[model samples]
Target: MIRPLLLLAAASLLLGCAQQTLRGTGDLGVVVERATGSVQIIETSHQTRLARIDGLGDLSHASVVFSRDQRYAYVFGRDGGLTKVDLLKQRIDRRVIQGGNSIGGAISQDGALIAVGNYEPGGVKVFDSKTLELVADIPATPLADGSRNSRVVGVIDAPGRRFIYSLFDTDETWLLDFSQGNTPKITRFKNVGKQPYDALLTPDGRYYVAGLFGEDGMAKIDLWHTRRGVERILDGYGRGEQKLPVYKMPHLEGWTVAGNQTFVPAVGQHRVLVMDSQTWKQTDAIDVAGQPIFVMARPDARQIWVNFAHPDNHQVQVIDSETHEIIATLEPGPAVLHMEFTARGDQLWLSVRDGNEVQVWDPYQLKLLKRLPAESPSGIFFSSRAHETGL
Candidate 1:
C-alpha cells in the first residue's frame, strides 16, 4: 500500500508540471489589430505569434502600457475602453469604460496606478492598477471662457510617481504628482503655446516638450527647473518658407535623442528637424521622403528611422545620427503607420496598415527578415516598455 501511494503522488506531480508552461514575460508583446479590435500575443525571441485575443473595442487609435512586472497590458482604446490583459493567460482580465473618448494612457512609476486622458469630457482619470478601480478624477482646466474643458493630450508617466500632459484648448502643460496619495498636487504652466497638439517626455524624465500646431515652434519645460516656465524652441522653423498642408499631425512621442542631438518630425514638411539637446536650439534639418510622421531612434541611438503621412507613407528613411544625413531609404509598404525597435535594437518592426502585415528587419543591414500577417495593424508595443519611463 505504501509503494502504491508513492507512485500515485509522483504521477500527480508529473501531471502538474505538464499542465504549466514555463516562460518569461520579457520576450512577450502584443500587436494591435486596429480593424478587428483585437491584439495578437507575440514573442520577440522567436519572432512568432502566440495567440490572438479579441473584443478590445474600437482600436482605431489604440495604445498600450505594461505593468511593472510585465505580466499584464493596459490597452487604451478610442471608444473609451481601458482593458487589462493578462499576458500569461492570453486574455482580458478586467475591462472598464473609463471615458467617452480616450486617446492614450500611462502607468505609474511604481506600477500602482493607471491614468487615462480623455477628450469628450476633457479630463484625466486615475485607476488602481491592480483592481482597475477609479482612484481619482481630475478634470482638465477649463478654458478662459469657461465654456468647456480643454482636451488633454500626450499623457505620459514621469519620475516621482507623477503624470505630465498637455492641454490643447488652454495652451497649458500640467504636472500631476501622486506620490503622496489619491489627492494629487497639480502644477500648471500657462501660455505654453497656441494649439499644443502633442507632447513628449525625455528618456531621463528631465524635459517635457509640446509641439505647437498653431505656431512655428515648440514649448519646452525643463522639469528639473520648472520656475523658468515654458521656453519656446525651434521658433520660426517655417517662418521664411511656405508650409504645406498637414496631412496628419506629427507625433512628438516618436522624437528621439541620440547623443547630444534630438531628432523630430517637422509638422507639414518633408524634413526631419535636428536640435541641439543641450541648448534646445535647431541645429539642422535633413530632407526626407515625405512629411515625416514618426522620427524614431534605434535603441542604440546610432540611426534615426522616419516614416511619413498619407501618400508618402510607403517609404521609410534612415538617417545617420552623427552626420545628420539620409543613410538609406526603403519602401516597406503602403500605409506604414508605426515602427518599434526590439529591446536591444537588433531588430526593427514596421506596421504596414494597407499591406496588412508587420515586417521585421535587420536594422544595420536594412534587410527584411520576416513578415507576419496582421489585420490593419497600427501600433506594435513590446513588454520591454514596462521598464522605460514615458513610453
Candidate 2:
C-alpha cells in the first residue's frame, strides 16, 4: 500500500510538469494571422509555437508594437480596434475601437503613449500605453479643399516624446509634440509632397522621409533641425522611364540605411534608388526582379533582401551591401507577404501566404531550413524590436 501511494504521487507530479504553460520572453515573437484575426506567439529559438490569441477583430491589415518590458503587445487592427495583449498570460488585458478604420500605429519614445493612424474619417488618435485611455485626438483636416477626411500614414515616434505623420489627401506633414503636457503642440508642414503614401524615420530618429504617390520625388524632414523644414529629394526619379502601372503602392518601410547609403524603392519602377545619407543625393540604382515592396538589410549589414509587390511577389532578391550588386534571387514560394530575421539575423523567416506556412532560411547559405504551418500570415515581429527606435 505504501509503494502504491508513492507511485500515485509521482504520477501526479509528472502530469503537472507536462501541463505547464509557456510564457512570452527571450527570443519570442508573433505571427499576424490576418484571415482568422489571431496572432500565434512563437518561441523562435526552439522553432516552437506557444499560443494563438484570437478575437482581435478585423486584422486584415494588422501591426503590433511591444511594450518596453516585452511582456505586452499592442495590436492595431484594420477595423480601428486596439488591443493590449499580455504576452506572458496569452490573453488580452484591454481593447477599444477608437475609430472607423486604422492603418498602423507607434509607441512613444518613453513608452508612455500610443498613436494610431486612420484611413476612414482620417486623423490620428493617441492613448495612454498603460491604461489605454484617450489622451488626444488630431484630425487630418484637408488643407486643399477643406475636406475633413485626410488619410494619415507613416505615423512614427521620434525623440522628445513626439509623434509625426503624413496626410495623403492634403499632401502635408504634421508633428505632434507631447513633452510639455497632455495637450499636444502641433506643427504642420504644408506642400511637402503630393500623396505621401508612407514614410520612415532614420534609425536614429533624426530624419523623416515620406514617399509620394502622386509625384516623382519624396519629401524629407530634418527632425534634429526642424528649422530647415521639409525638402524634396530624388526629384524626377521616375522621369524618362515608362513606368508599369503600380498595382500596390511601393512600401517606404523598405527605406533603410546600409552603411552611409540609404536604399529607397522607386514607385512603379523595378529599381531601388541608392542615396548618400549625409547629402541625400541619388548615388546609384539597383535593378530588381519587380517593383520592390521591402528592402531590408541583414543585422550585420552584409546583405540586403528585396521583396516584390506582385506578379513577382514569390521571389526575394539578395544584394551584397559591400559590392552594391545582386548576389542571389530566391523563390521562397507564392505570395510571400513578409520576412523577418531572427534577433541575431542568422535565420530569416518568411511568410508564404499561398502556401499557408512560414519558412526559415539561412541567409548566408541561402538555403531553406524549416517550415511551420500558419493561417495567412502577413507580418512577423519579434520582441527584440522593442529596444529599437522608429521601428
Q: Could you say which candidate leads in TM-score?
A: 1
Model 2 TM-score?
Answer: 0.94
- Which sections of candidate 1 miss by over 4 Å? 1-20, 144-147
What number of backbone clashes does candidate 2 have, counting pairs of residues 3 or more apart or in separate chains? 0
lDDT of 2 by residue, 1-391 (tens): 9999999999998988867754447588889999999998887888878889999999887888888888888999999999998888888899999988999889998889999999977999999999999999998875457756799998888899999999998889999999997799999998898899899889888999999999999999999888889999999998999989887776676577877988888899999899998999999999999999888889888998989988999999998887879999999889898888887888898899888998889998999989999999988888887887776
Off by over 4 Å in 2: 1-24, 143-147
Clashing pairs in 1: none
lDDT of 1 by residue, 1-391 (tens): 9999999999999988977787889988889999999999899887999999999999998999999999999999999999999999999999999999998989999999999999978989999999999999999988789887999999999999999999899898899999899899999999899989988899899999999999999999888888899999999898877799999888888999888999998887888999999998888989888999899999999999999998899999999998888889899999999999989998999999999999999999999999999999999999999999987
Report lDDT per candidate: 0.92, 0.89
Choose the strongest candidate by lDDT.
1
The clash count of every prediction, one per candidate, is 0, 0
Write down the TM-score of every candidate. Answer: 0.96, 0.94
